[model samples]
Target: MAKQSTKNKLDTSALRPLLRYAKPHMWLFILSMVFAVITVATTLYAPILVGNAVDLIIAKGLVDFDGIINIIIKLSVTVTVTGIAQWLMSLCTNKITYCVVRDIRNDAFAKLQKLPLSYIDSHPHGDIISRIISDLEQVSDGLLMGFSQLFTGVCTIFGTLGFMLSINVKITLIVVILTPLSLFVARFIAKNTFKLFHQQSVARGDMTSLVEEMTGNQKVVTAFGYQEEAEEQFEEVNLKLQKVGLNATFFSSLTNPCTRFVNNLVYMAVGIVGALSVIKGVGFTVGNLSCFLTYANQYTKPFNEISGVITELQSAFASAKRVFEVIDETEEIPDSSNATVLTSVDGTLDVDNVSFSYVPDVKLIENFNLHVKSGQRTAIVGPTGCGKTTMINLLMRFYDTDSGEIRISGEPIKDCTRDSMRSMYGMVLQETWLKTGTIRENLCYGKPDASEEEMIAAAKSAHCHGFIKRLPKGYDTVISDSYSTISAGQKQLLCIARVMLSLPPMLILDEATSSIDTRTEILVQRAFEKMMQGRTSFIIAHRLSTIKNADTIIVMDSGHIVEQGSHDELMAKNGFYADLYNSQFAVT
Candidate 1:
């Protein structure tokens, strides 16, 4: 049984990755700070002006209309100017945030390119995509909008407190008495909100993976009449996601209302206290009381803003933790630090005493040895689960051998850079994956620098040119959906064409023609003959006739090579290869 993963926890260390992205926007952040200062200063001045107006009316026993108009005009102008400044600052902040997000996406993609095949095998594609899309968006929201509001709120809160105390310390003290209680509630909501958001992200990834699987295997689902089963599975995941999402929403939604309620209670307390002070002849005027009340009301604005920001902060931090998990993962098969470029290679290959296992206790290959001279063709014939594909995987450095070494051109593959090692071989797997794009684009993927003429020649060599030419746009024809326009044979041929375009010195064919019809197989086999000439090749074939002309053949059983030699020699021995050949050809 698989070990259960540990519960998701907030990783404060994840914040360090954000600093690299923020460095470029330091100047803009500083400007936003300046704008925040101006905004806060303008906001705090309003209560003081009202207080002064009240004093003037009480002292003179008459309303000074001119004085009041002047104060109103000055306050309005200050507010307008400060609002413009804040807008300018917000524009710059948003630009920086989006740019950082774009960089993060690019970085993730680049890192994926460098990762070994084993990493991809261990992780699902949809989960990786969720980190790049949904997770990054959450982080961006926090950095762009949440950070600005948080900073402004903190500044406003402290700034308002300072001015309030200056006017009347007694009233200020009463209003702020319940702040700690509000903060405690905010903290509780934030903690639970983070947990819920993390669960939501995981559930979303699971749903994405299920949807991708169902879409990609719709034919199998329909053929097996398993639509109800699939729908049930999907609903199970979707309902789980809904539960987590609702919990996250509920926790986040509680922040504002709870903060507002506490703030109102504090305001009422302040009113009661101020009225008692006036009744007791504490020299509190009506204007003084009114100004203090206004300031008290202003005090809750920052708390509300902060509560909202806390919810966003929790989500952002959760997303950042996920992204950092990817970034922090040590690549299991990284290139050597001092590895050199292999500009050209001759395809001499050797595998000495190789052993491997995906799991710790089960061995896939043990004491395996193989050799192919430059320009030689070798075939590995095996029953299912006999480790033939694993041999190919080791040769391509998809997974490093657990013991012993693999060498190409007499150099250990581990010593060479992965880029250079991969550059020397052309591979075609059992399942052909074609991207949604033009024929030319897919063909050129293996050799981006290949000219248009070279692409056409490769297509012809793969025997796909005739079908491609029949399409509406020939090489430029677009394949929107993988299933609608292309048959399995066509996709396999396209894979062949793509490999041919690469023109590598070594080739590995892993049931490359398995999905094609017999006629198309003959065409593909002929093309393979042309492409494999004078190149080291490894053929893992299911059809016995396909490898009849191979220079050498090896039969494998239970992860061990059991028979070796030419096809006739193996037949003469009447051993495992002979049995396999007889069993396969008996019906034919």
Candidate 2:
């Protein structure tokens, strides 16, 4: 993992991640654009028909009622058909937008799975969740409403301008003058809004983190009587979010009204100019003047639409930038490009001069060396934070050693595929994490293809069958939400059963009996001893008495192995192991 100071900042320029989703729907986009152009052309033609109808009635005084009726019928059909076409275009736009958003969300989540644990530790869970949910939703809104409309509106503006110039070049020039001024105002508002929108997204992430923290730790707050403190902290985050939101809203608010004002000014100028041109006998007929006015009104529609879409575009761009930042993060502990799968294993393990640290410039394990013969039982004991758990992590290949190598069966773990390597070992942690399922399902977690008899036998070996059999539904009882119905010790036993079912050649027990009472711990220890027979095992324990009978007991301190031997040899030396034993279990 990179150092905190060097962690990549959110790069707004890394928005190409969205293209992976957009590419698949290019054909849909093309179809929608075709329909949109057709709709815009039909809409622009309607104004000309209306203007000609007025000229026939008022200027030439040639009513021709039947001809006027026929023109009206054709205009109605065109309007209806074009309206249906626009609706079809909207449906296509929505389909493409939804598929793109779905792909992005899926890719981002898959990337998270491959990310190192260190990244997760540094970043907030709620903040990550917010990006996946709220940020992606913002991107979807932009693609569906903003991008689609901007495409159609731009086409409409140019097409309308072309028709207006064809009807009367003088009026077209007057309308075209407002376009640059409107664009200038839009650019100015967009610059400020983008900055404010970025700030708002950050503030919102902070708020989400605060809320998640408070909710998850509510029990701690009540127990420690820190309700007021939690509330004050929440209020501070809320205030910051409010300030950022107000700033974003304030800038985005200016875009519409300013553009509309410019448009209204242009409309007034066109009216005045048209009246003068008529009185001066400049060959401006009633039809030409009416069409020019209609075209003038049509020109402002795109400007207004663009101004509105600018705000959404800024937000969408910000969301795209955030989502891409996550996708672009380098996987700190990536699998080796040439790594091969480990299909067979005998479980002999070796750690040779291994060194590691979670943070740079701080060593947690220094020149750590250990060797476990296949099918031997070994226990690691040390003071808190003496790198006992770190040793297990290195053995499991969760984090690569900063120096030296770790090997299984004489093969360096780094060269082995992660899945095939992990499949060879069964790990039981201090806390048992059970999904919402029946007892049978939890038991089969490790070896999903285990037969019923195999599951029952494993359960018996782990000392879990007795309790499970007492339940009304036995193995069929459904467990809900973290398996709250089971006792902590029962959950631990079930996890042990899960490991037993897998029957891997290697096993790791990291404080696996910490949650059970002393009597239950002794029972579990007996089951563990039986299970460890004929399998290489590494056990990390806080309770020294539980591991007293191990074949080898290694004592660690300050990232080095201070002492190692059988129980009697270590006690006879009266060194760090002796001191820890006397202090913890000596009994004054």
Tens digit per residue, CA lDDT, model 1, 58-102? 565588889888888887887797788778768777877888788
- Candidate 2 residue 116 Cα shift, in angstroms, is 2.0
Report how far residue 296 has shifted in candidate 2, in Å: 1.8
For model 2, state the Cα shift of residue 98 in Å: 1.6
The global C-alpha lDDT for each of the candidates, from Candidate 1 onward, is: 0.83, 0.84
Q: State every prediction's TM-score relative to the real structure.
A: 0.93, 0.92
Segments in model 1 whose C-alpha atoms lie over 4 Å from true places: 1-11, 50-62, 276-283, 480-484
TM value for model 1: 0.93
User: Candidate 2 residues 1-588, lDDT tens each?
Assistant: 443222123223533556667788999888898888988999888888887777678535558787689889989988997898799899889989899889889988998988877788799988888788888898899778765788789888999989988877877898898766776787678756776777777778888888887787787889999999988998998999899899898889899889888888888888889878888878887777787787788788788878788777777777777777787788756668889788878879898999999988887899888898988889999999999988888888777889999999999999888888998899999967888889999899888899999999999888889989999899998875332677878888889889989988899999998778888777778888888999999888888888888889999998999999998999999999989888886666
Q: Which ten residues in a row have the lowest lDDT in candidate 1?
A: 1-10
Give the local distance difference test score of model 2.
0.84
lDDT of 2 at 501: 91
